[model samples]
Target: MREQASYLRIADDLRRRIAGQKWASGEQLPSRAALAREFGVSGAIIRRAQEALITDGVLEGRAGSGTYVAEQRKRCRMVRFQATGQAGAGYRGPDLGVLGEGETWEGRSDVMTPAPAEIAARLGVDEGAYCVRTAYEHLVDDKPVYLTTSWEPYDVTKGSLVVLPDGGPLAGAGVVRRMAELGISVTRTQERSEPGTTNAEEANLLGVQRGTPCTRIERTFYSDDGRAVETADIIVPSVLCEIVYELPVSRS
Candidate 1:
């Protein structure tokens, strides 16, 4: 059998040390040169080993500071909407926290003069169609936890009282109630979730490292008559939040 690479072997040794509590959480690790000398390896090999640990979330690097063991992340559980749950059945605008405490949400809305093609497709409208877009940041104690962008076709909302999702009389009212005011009953929702890596923009928005694991959810709401009314894309940092889906089962 081919032997494992030197850097990988060193990384495995470090992992065992960490698991054995030789280094406590949030404790700083030895410098690369120091570790290299102790391990009888080149500095480059030590650096690679450390990088592996960083990617595993066992270590974190701070600018101008040495590497340190990462602290256990505080995880928030987010409960998804159930078809039978009254609290989450409709478009309540930006209700972020389902079971987490000390969480707050802020939203900003704008009218997209020309909506993007993908968003237009989700809303069942033509490209360049006017749409109302809202961006939201969910935070825990002022730290970003997740981000989302919601789009609604302007054709369904123009000249209506619910033009702005977070404005006018229906401000903060979820999509279902606002649409009901316009005689549109939202009866169904569809959601798709996938894993992804954070890009620079998302990393900055969520205050996480670039390339961190994340969850992306695409959601759409449909009216009773099968008209798509609204769509949203939500990005969540994996380390900070856990997405939980509570599915309902029917018995015959």
Candidate 2:
């Protein structure tokens, strides 16, 4: 038990070190023999530490080149919304307090524009229909976490909204919540987050280099009547967020 505990501690410590930039992404971790010497343990202990990091998506061990820090990608943990009988009931509005002061809505100066042909087709709108576009950058601890743009039919939102107050309508809250009051409920949410690179504009906003690893999230929201109402393109920094999922095993 003591040996296992020590190995876990070593793995956790190494994880923090990588996250802290002591060992940058794509860089190799110390050799098992070296790490074993550093931790005053056997090579097997160091091997166990590497295994833990691999399981956690922090490091990858190549066949011969050694263990390298994995590209920073946030892992998603599964969070199942309980069937509290509220799945179909209208979603409650999240208080502005829940969004906090960390992220603010900096107003946009540009007018809303129509989406590309592909997007227009998906939204069941004509390519020429006026769409209100709102852009936002969410910051955490003064660092940008996501750069996003949301589009809605101009005929729907009345007009483009900018600079909503903290916790105010459209503040901190995702588009799904904002439209709930308008009788627009999200009957379905499709999210596909994958490894991607930052574009020139996104890199400028995120203070990162173009082509930096990022997670692109595109979500389309639908009204209760099953009509698509809004679409959002969210760009998340790979280093900061993680996705988590849990599975229930059946016992027969």
Candidate 3:
């Protein structure tokens, strides 16, 4: 068997100390150099240990300030009802809360954005095709919790009442109802979710450590003819919410 890395050993010890109340929640930790000297390990090892803890939500980094214990966060349960004709049958409920309660969001739309390769492929459109992209910031008590960016092929709803997702007579009515306004019937929804680390943009927008852990959800809405009408990326910070999917059994 191979020996464990020095950083993992250090990380384990750090967890023990935190568990034992050596470092209380929201309290800053000693400097990397100081910890390295005390542990008789290299600064790089200490840095790695702290980074691992940060990713696990056990600790957090402050820009130019240093590392600190993460505060206890009440992770909201973001539920996705997979069964048809059920209540809250959407990726995100009206509000982020478990029962669709207190939460607000801000949305902005860009109608002239060109679809990148991946997005174009998802929308079944050519690369550089014009698309309406909308970005949303979901917040609780004015504190940002998550984000959603949506892209729909321009040709699908151009020159219609639903051109701008956040605009139009049916504004904020949701994709299904909006498409229904355009005489388009949306039949199915697909999603794929994975764990990932936050990038610089996400970190800055979410007000978290640069390397904080997050859940990335790729979602697409399709019509009866099997055409993808819209696709979106949902970014949920790990410390803010827990995603739950309720899948009903098929009685076929």
Residues 1-252 of candidate 2 have per-residue lDDT tens digits of 989998999998998898789999889888899999999998998899898777556787688789998765333221223221133343332211112234343434234576777668757799978776767665555655567676666666663352231234465454556566566666775555678988878866765556768778676667778777777677765655443333356698
- Candidate 2 accuracy as TM-score: 0.52
Ranking of all predicted structures according to lDDT, beginning with the best and ending with the worst: 3, 1, 2
Please report, in order, the local distance difference test score of every candidate based on alpha carbons.
Answer: 0.80, 0.63, 0.81
**lDDT of candidate 3 over 1-252, digit per residue (tens):** 112388898999999999999999999999999999998988988998998888676898889999999887566766666633344454333222242456667788999799999999999999999999999888776777888899998898888888887776766667877888888988898888899989988887876777778999898889999999999998998878778877778899
What's each prediction's TM-score? 0.69, 0.52, 0.68
Clashes of 1: 3
- Any residue pairs clashing in model 1, and if so which? 91-174, 91-175, 92-174
* TM-score (C-alpha) between model 3 and the true structure: 0.68
Q: Candidate 3 — which residues are off by over 4 angstroms?
A: 1-72, 83-99
Better of 1 and 2 by lDDT: 1
